[model samples]
Target: MLSSVLRSLQSLTTHNNEHQECATPGSSTARDPRKQVLMSSTTFSGAGPSVGKRLNIDGDIPDPSHQLPALPSNLPPPNATYEHSTPPQIPKYINAYSLFLAGSIEMGAAITWQRHMAQFLHHLPLTICNPRRGHWDPDSRPQPSDANFRTQVEWELEALSNASVICFFFDVNTKSPVTMMELGLWAHSGKVIVCCGEGFWKGGNVKLVCERYGIPCVNDFAELVVEAKRMLKQKGLDAVTDEEIQRDEEWAKGIVARKARKEA
Candidate 1:
């Protein structure tokens, strides 16, 4: 009975060893079918490699370090048409003109001149001289009673000299003393003076001064711009098309000459 029990125990031990060998693979054995299926499904997809794994497929990913080279620094600046040995001289014969819109600061003529000048000749340098309390403050107020009026006058004279042309505006029905003074000053200084005054300004001090100084006086701002451009070309500071300049000059000259003929 004891020998029989020992044989039964040995048989049971051999069966248990066989079961353990089937449950766990040896070190050199291949992966199990379940593990191979799981790894293939999780690591390989149509969207490339899995998030954490490096892709092993042929021609699947690009190297990230290579990039296009930057442009060179010796390239010329854009929109540079010409390079001059010397700076182009400021047109002396009135390539740039300033407008001295002179009238009562609150008047319609002043407003009209400002609007038209801003619209038509916006590119030109214009200086409107209408002093007001708002423009004068603690920092830049003018001394009314100061005897330094000569200094102001000289400064204005210098501005006129620097500018190739000057323009003045006045209202015929209501002439401001300050406007008249400015017109007179520009006229006396021999600056190219163009005046835009009311139609009735024909037989007044403004008209008389314009006539005496040979200053071109017009009743319209549009006509004033045409005349100013023509004068610039006549003085040889403008190199624009001759046909255009001549057409404008003919129109202005016709108006002036006809007016003169009618007066005669």
Candidate 2:
């Protein structure tokens, strides 16, 4: 009976050992090479305590406060400052040279009118359109040369497009067919049109045309110049100053003196 009891006790001990081995994490299965390496390294290195135990070294971990303080429901209003600044004045000669001069080229009055206008507005640039010359042709091939009329008209239109202003010098005595067309084009393009002529010859048609198109017409070239200067000033270009006028007068006198000397 003692021998049987000893054998039974040994068998129970062996079964417990097998059970423990099966319960252990890696012992029952074929261990991964990497996992085995890691375990062996940990054992040899005598690694510190598990992370959980290390983190809670002092006492039980405290839970965060259940009730969080409420944030402000309304944000503070923004503080902003705005500044208003004045605009700079326009330059004196803005778009001065880029002007188109249209009129009756055949008439002497038209020439005189154009010359006066040009002289008065010397500071501004001017391009005269002569329909009689026809268009600008470098080859110069075409009969009657008048065929080039369309070419001149095209050139004038191009100049008009580039111009800041279009001044029409109309003569009531010699009503130019082309002048009306040019004026109409200028009006349609919203160009500033300044018409100049004498009152002796009835300007009813011209006056009516200007009235219909809302163009400014003046009898005197000097008055036209004044008006043009005022218009330019309003647009912030060429503000009239007494000093500038005086300077211009002095310059004119010098030119006259030179001319007189040359003539003598």
Which lDDT tens digits does candidate 2 get at residues 1-264? 223323433454465346434544455322321111111000111111234322111122111211111222342222121111111211233333344556544212123354344445444332332222211222322223544433444555666676555666654343344455456556645556654454423255556556666777765344455455444444444434555555544644554455448659
Candidate topping lDDT = 2
Error of 2 at 7 (Å): 99
Residue range 1-264, candidate 1, lDDT tens digits? 222323433454465346335554433221322111111111111222223433222122221211111222442233122111101112222323343333332212123343333333333333332121111111211333433333343444454455545656543332233445456556755555554444432225566667777778766444565665555555453443477556656665666566558669
TM-score of each: 0.43, 0.43
Q: Candidate 2 at residue 16, lDDT?
A: 38
Residue 30 miss distance in model 1 (angstroms): 99
Q: What shift in Å separates residue 58 of candidate 2 from its native position after superposition? A: 99
**Residue runs of model 2 more than 4 Å from their true location after superposition:** 1-97, 107-109, 124-148, 196-202, 239-264
Error of 1 at 39 (Å): 98
List clash counts for every candidate, in order.
0, 4
